[model samples]
Target chain A: MSLELIRDILVATVPLLLIFPTLFAFTTWLERKALARIQNRIGPNKVGVPLTRYGGRFSLFGLGQPMADGIKMLFKENIVPRDADRLFHLLAPILALIPAMLVLCFLPIDFPWINNIQDSVKAFMLDGAVIFFFAITGLNTLAVFMAGWASRNKYSLLGGMRAIAQMVSYEIPLVLSAVIVVMMVGSLNAAEIANAQAGWNWFIFTPWGLAAFIIFFIAALAETNRSPFDLPEAESEIIAGYFTEYSGFKFALFFLGEYIAMFAISGLAVTLFLGGGAGPGVAALPWLSVIWFLVKIFALIAVMIWLRGTLPRLRVDQLMGFAWKFLLPLSILNIFIAGSALHLLAGGRLAGLDEKQPILRQLMEGANPLVVAGLWIGALLILYVAANGLNQLSRAKVRPREYKYAE
Target chain B: MSEQIAFWILSAIAVLGALVAVRKRNLIHGVFALMIFFAALSGLFLLLLAEFIAAVQILVYIGAVGILLLFAIMLTERVAGDDGRRMTSRGWFWGLVVAAAVFVVLLLPAIQQWPTPEVTQAPDPSVEELGHKLMNPYVMTLEVLALLLTAALIGAVTAAQGMRKPKEEGSPE
Candidate 1:
């Protein structure tokens, strides 16, 4: 390849490779500190930057904790189970990481450095970029399964099974919810979707968009195996799930992969629902779009961390039921609602609205905004009732646990 | 030159993966190897500029089918297959002969240097174009395929549920 081509490829990818992993390191410290603060305790306060000869005195509130953890992991002994498939055990973490890193390219973060890059090298420039993102992220389940089964441990196997089932179940709602955006924009290209939502035209502001965003967020939380839906790696249940037998750098790799996947999915959510980098001052200062993008991502990540601190991990049955029964139907319905609303308001079908609203036609020639708004309200109500009914229908009627001898 | 290199590398990976999938004795390993083949084939599709098909290949074949195979293997008695007697069938000679015959048939056009159809113009590779084609001209075919898949899914679910009567519950205890 020519030097310019090589440079273009590097310009396209190098920032993502450097930025997200660094963010991953910092996010670990942030999660711990945040979770600790939630629990009324200080976390990682001792690992600060060293200034003096004796490991420095200014312990900057554990800012150096992730670096310290990295070093510790590097020096720690690599452990492998005797009966494990050593090849798969070695491959699993790498497999887990590759897809997570690959999907990062599909996020439309417009850095100034990448502004001059050729379209061929930019992953999100593709017409089916969103679908490609889902396809790549789907491989993460196989890696988790590989780690679980390769470990040759029952708990690991259980964790793998749970991860696969949960991921496969949640992916439907996740993709379905995202389809609303693609439907709205009439393109699957991330850049196009983001551009369609320019100047506060974020899909999240619309009723169907809001519902789709909510479903997408909930499904994303499950997709990343985040808290309230972390049945796959529930420590209390399966002892860290798929990576139960992984140690040291391998374990750290899994951790890094998980955090990156969280960032990637959050990036996609921001891209699909939050108008991507379409914040103010972006036209004058193009680079500000990167800040807006990261800000949106971190905002989503903060909510994830907050939920982690608040909601307990879901039970397996509850997790499956929530996806298949609740989120799936709602997302499917949201697509139809969004589609019909689009056809009514913006699209040129002009199908049945005029005949139904003859009185409104008397007020003005084409004043159908109230009619459209009313239709949206009615649609949202149906969605609300449907959601509640599905919730009621899918709920398992198990009696509360009885404590007779406790305390 | 870059495309050639990518094509060669991806084709190599696809071939090796398929070979390993067919040859491996361990069921799980075989399934994973098949997934590798699917993934590599998707890469080849991407190389061919068929990004939609590439994504769908990974989505349907690797993400769905590979996972299904893994689940099926997990459900079996001896998933590891460590106690395997023989993987190859006793009719290996016939199998090879039939395989060779099929391969020869498939290669006939290329081997004879048959004249390929000339393109009036290069078709747009954009997924939007594909979507228009599918929804406009091929909508019936697409809908039929969707219905067929849905039927298969429902049939599988029904078979899994089986024809058993519901249990008579007397008490919550």
Candidate 2:
């Protein structure tokens, strides 16, 4: 509408647009290097610095690889199957990219230039931003389905179905775990949640919060179709999954979309569990909060890459059973544990701590150390017992060796 | 002016999506078109400053209902769909008549002013307020709805498992 409003919108969003794609390129390089090192090899070493002669002497740890790969992908031929649905084939990558990019706006990463803008852009200001994040994230399944169905390949179709099933199942635990944070914070605002956990008061420090964070991260991995839950794109079984028929820039778009989704979900995890932008000296220099936030995001992303390198993809039934039987029930029980813990700790009238004190300080001061320790031990033991019982109940009666023979 | 532009654009998209959803011969295409309509409807809700409703609208209708429709279609018929299939029915006239009647009935309140209760203080529309309302005054209704949904879910699961259990138990090789 107005020039100021337009400028403010750009100031808020353009940073996200630029930062994430750049991070994605870096992540691609990072993932290759990390995974390579894990498997005992050098990765992308030959792709030296651009605009330099091919001596490979002035290399940047093969940092130029993503750039070279981008160029190659750009020049590659865009292929479409003869019998595929042309419209959906064209639309699928675009659809996949939309929700991923959109959710980035909801992350509470306060850039320095943000001070210049007013409240014209309400992306981060929405009251239901957390819920909005989950809602938009759900739309990716349709894109996966679209890509799968549009390809008209049986394997692609199977990939799409598996993706939809996996995403839908994992989303329950994802949202349920997030519910613990929302319940504790008493607001769904991203910024509010972050501010609520200012300095060392991250939700992850508490027992139930720790359980929730683990559940949330695992579910987030599945939601993003990352390794260990990448049944949708299992190469050995269903080719490349939903993107089997995709090539060139369309394939690149899907890759970018998936990575951005990874960043958005991880950013959310940071905002909710890890103290978002909450670091030492952040109060002294407000601009450092953005750096802190990015550091936290990278920390989570590094863990995701680590998990990817370390684990094998799960079987379909095992995946579903873990989500529904294990994570789902565990996360639900986790909420009860969180609520009661909050009541006894924070919400109880007996507590005489000052209102302005941090949660941990209040928790320690309000109750005796012995009582708090006892409560923590009690909660952990309950969780251990519950998790063990759920595992026993959900495990198939037939052993894995017998299962393979039967198959 | 911005709001007006957005409203018109969103409304156009919604109408176009609904028409495409109803008229498409392919079930998957129709379901996706329906999702587009739902997305547009959520945009409209956002425009009305009902963020919670807008989020829930997309979350439930497009995410849950749309996927359910796709699964049902995959189960019941060919996904690629028959090209020569008719998009209209023999009773299409009556269907149109009924749809129009319902639409007009729904639009009547908008066309004509109606007496409504007025409070001195406008209620807060923030999510916090909504939660408070739900947990306090409307908790009974909310719990009842939850109960109903839970029953339906359990009933559906039992019905699905019912068809398989007898076959597994009674069959002898």
Candidate 3:
């Protein structure tokens, strides 16, 4: 409502608006490249103009492919199916795209861009960013459903249903993991969480913090409909899924929304787990902090790309089972761990006795570095074994039987 | 002025969307209109300084409920068209009567509670305060909501499983 607040909103939004398009563009290129690598072939080698003057290619490894794709989608004919609900069909993509775009408002790209006018003038500040982020991302499910339903295609409807189930299931774990972060930092503001993890004692370093990070990462994958959780658009099974009936720029908008959502989740992961824009003693050079933040985000995005390349799509039942049986329980446990840890860190009393008293303090002291590291390694090893066991079980379960249903 | 303008715009959209949601013949259009209604409600919540609530409304209603409704409509073959099959006998007369009664009832409240020119400042609900209230004061309620969500999950899976079985067995072709 105030001028400073308005300025803060503008300042926070501009970089996101600028960066998102580029991220979306690059992520598309990244996905193509990764998928191509998986298939052992070159991808998008001839999209951009060649720079003859410097004897170098003008493009940065098919960087301009997104632009080319966008242009092509724009020029292509927009078709409305005869059986489709005209009003709903036309409105669906816009609805989906707008909500996806609106999520950036609550995400803090970095610390408040403070400027000194009369000692202190906070340039960009947001409260309750975590809630805002989740809330906006949640709207994505609606847009997806609308697209599917409005299309009047059975495949689209099925895709939409799958998406809704996936999104709803993942959202719980996502919120629960965020609750853990909120417990650790004692704040919901994205910037505040980053500030809390200013030094090497990042949340991702702690036991509960690590749990929250993994839970959040998996939930994010499901939320974004990326592989191995991309059941919504399983091309072989669903035939482009929800977007099957869409074409041209309308289809482009849905694609853009997908990439933007991916960027948003990656940015959130960096902010929550990787200490955000915080770098080693980078407070002296504030600009470097932003660079560090971006690096972390891109790294997270690369992980998403790697996941797409390495993992197979999960079975629908398996995805749902994992969400309910594994993610939900783990996230709930993470929350309890985070809450107790924060309570100890805050030096709060255990029952009636003072937590700072000599005996109690010794008992409630911070986790030993070695113990923490050992516990982390142990947990990782257990997880690896469990994952491998599950993989083996699924393979055994799905193997073709000797008795076939042949005539 | 901006705030007032935003309020009016959102209010208008909300009213229009609600009307379309209820009156639209096509079920899909009705659902899409409901989405607009949810968006308008979220915007109004934002204008009222309940950003968290606004976000939740968008998340829960638009994201979850809207999708559920869409799926329900799409999956049911009976609700797919507007071939006069959806209209009940004497529907038009009842609809008009209901519409008139609702309009009168709504107008009566506005007429009885006429607006004053002077505006009173209300306490802004800060997110921090809300967070404390949620965890410290309403923790039990939060737990109950979590339980409710779990129940919903179980119910949905059971229902979907029931649906899946018949389809799988019946599809001999």
The candidate that wins on DockQ is 2
Report the C-alpha lDDT of model 2 over A1-407, residue by residue, as the tens digit: 77888788888888889999999999999999999999999987777878779737766798889999999999999999999999999999999999999999999888888877786485767889999999999999999999999999999999999999999999999999999988877788898888888758788877888999999999999999999999999999999999999999999999999999999999999999998999999989999999999999999999999999999989999999999999998998998987787677765553555433344535644577676777778778888899999999999788455455665
TM per candidate, chain B? 0.84, 0.80, 0.79
Candidate 3, residues A367-404, lDDT tens digits: the string is 46565566556555555565455555544245566766
lDDT, candidate 2, B11-72, per-residue tens: 99999999999888888999999999999999999878788999999999988999989998
Give the top-scoring candidate (lDDT). 2
Q: Which 10 consecutive positions of candidate 1 chain B have the poorest summed lDDT?
A: B116-125
In model 2, pairs of residues that clash are none
**Model 3 lDDT tens row, B28-121:** 7787788889989998987777877887897778777887787677667556556766454568889889979999999997887576565568
Query: What is each predicted model's overall lDDT from 0 to 1?
Result: 0.88, 0.89, 0.75
Cα deviation of A19 in candidate 2 (Å)? Answer: 0.7
TM-score order of candidates, best first? 2, 1, 3
**What are the iRMS values of all candidates?**
0.6, 0.5, 2.4
Please give the ranking of all candidate structures by lDDT, highest first, separated by commas.
2, 1, 3
Q: Which residue runs of candidate 2 sit more than 4 Å off their true CA positions?
A: A120-122, A346-365, A400-407, B101-109, B113-123, B160-173
